[model samples]
Target: MKKQSFHIDGAKVTVYLDGPAWDGKPSATLGAFSCKTMQSGTSVLAQAISFVRDQGLNQIIGPMDGDTWHSYRFVTQTDGSPSFLLEPGNTPDALEVFKKAGFTEISGYFSARVPVVKTALTTPTATTDFTIEAWNGTHPEALFDQVFNLSTQAFARNAFFKPITRDDFMAMYMPMVPMLKPELIFFARQPDQTLAGFLFGTPNYAEGPKPTSAILKTYASLSKGAGQHLAHAFHKAAAAEGYETAIHALIHDDNLSAIRSASEGADIFRRYGLFGLKLNG
Candidate 1:
């Protein structure tokens, strides 16, 4: 088997595929891990990132093997319970290596799977306080911009936040619009009619076991009560769309807000983690 490898002083490195493609662009990715120390690890990561960038990749997000949305996370502890980022070994440093290489944390997402039998999974609870709505029109660039703005603000508290350039954001979502089924996207609005947050999902209601689409990625504004209320409302939207199980797409352990949101939901599931890096900027 002819395989390619990149090695840095006294270390062996490997690259792995992240996901399917659209119009020849990478859809998602997660770079594999096999580093020894700070120097070698950082070198290996930098080389990998530069390679992805050279490939004409629009935006790169990880602990992931590929893009910004899949298989990417940093483990903080060995307790097997990352409750509160459980103080894991060498994780904090790995990301540090990434940061040194010019990457930034853009947005933090989550994972929650509503069981099929939980018939009430999609219905918002009576105690829910926010107003949940959907974007019903065609290719609302304004709506997507709004989602980017609201989520950017909500995610500002992120330790490694790197403002996603408008171009980058668009490049990531534009391909998924048709695949995302906007009707299933639920937005949480405040009394003032501002987009406080939202949730997006795709239903795999087709006759076969294959997902009706690829993994559905959700974005929302993080605010007071935004976590639970938005989750419930989004759940309602997802069920109405006919999904068998809800998949919370991408997430990070360092993201305090997302971690909190996961707690409020009853059925939260996960996909994968990415390798994260911090940019010198």
Candidate 2:
């Protein structure tokens, strides 16, 4: 991947060429797109387009910081709800800027929310070979190592997935350690003590003055029903913690996780987009 930048009349934009796409494909992306753009101030957009052409890239995806590992989508639809933690915040003008620059929606994502009480009765079928436990801040490194291993396989087929070293993975989560609530994170283990799944949750730090909500950040499984088992256990634990609302953060429209969120009575309150443009157009 190659990184390039531009400064057009004091407006700066950054672009990446041949980077990983959501589906682990390679594509060019325009990002770090910042400017007080108006109808007359669209030079920045034109410059970005020029950069894509100069790179000999046939297509360009945008607003992606670099990859899915960081921030990527634009908030294409919203119910006027306040943003949640890790949620992308896009301005109205930013959306128009991309649209005017010949970009089209290439992918869609949504975040949903459900009341903890609604999922209180959610229970996955019992699996005799697997056991579930809460993450209690015990030997976090070891736990993370196990999670990284499972994730390497579980998310290998996921969009924009890039193989990362164990150290890099731990480093990413280490900063969030202070905000972690043990009850909200769970792990599923097999009879042989192999880690099979994990569910990560966090307090809704984005909810107004005080966060009455929590976010189901991410979860992965190496066994059947393990994901559901972890979610059920995590939701019950969140309810016990007095959290009224639970957010299913950023589910792809066609992803199975979205169905699970819907089954739990969650409603899609926010939608996001990853835009793309063909250089020839």
List the candidates' TM-scores in order.
0.54, 0.91
Clash tally, candidates in order: 39, 3
Tens digit per residue, CA lDDT, model 2, 1-281: 47888776646667888566543445787777766655433677787778778767677787886666667888888899888888878678778888888889988899998998888788877888789999887777787788789888998887666577777789887778777888899999999888989999989887765678989999999888888888888789888989998899998888888889999899989999988876664
Q: CA lDDT of each candidate? A: 0.52, 0.81
* Residue 172's lDDT in candidate 1: 77
State the lDDT at 164 in candidate 1: 60
lDDT of 2 at 89: 84
Off by over 4 Å in 1: 1-112, 116-130, 204-216, 253-281
User: Could you give candidate 1's per-residue lDDT for residues 142-194 as a string of tens digits?
Assistant: 77888788767876654434356677788777776665566667778777787
Clashing pairs in 2: 22-159, 22-160, 24-160
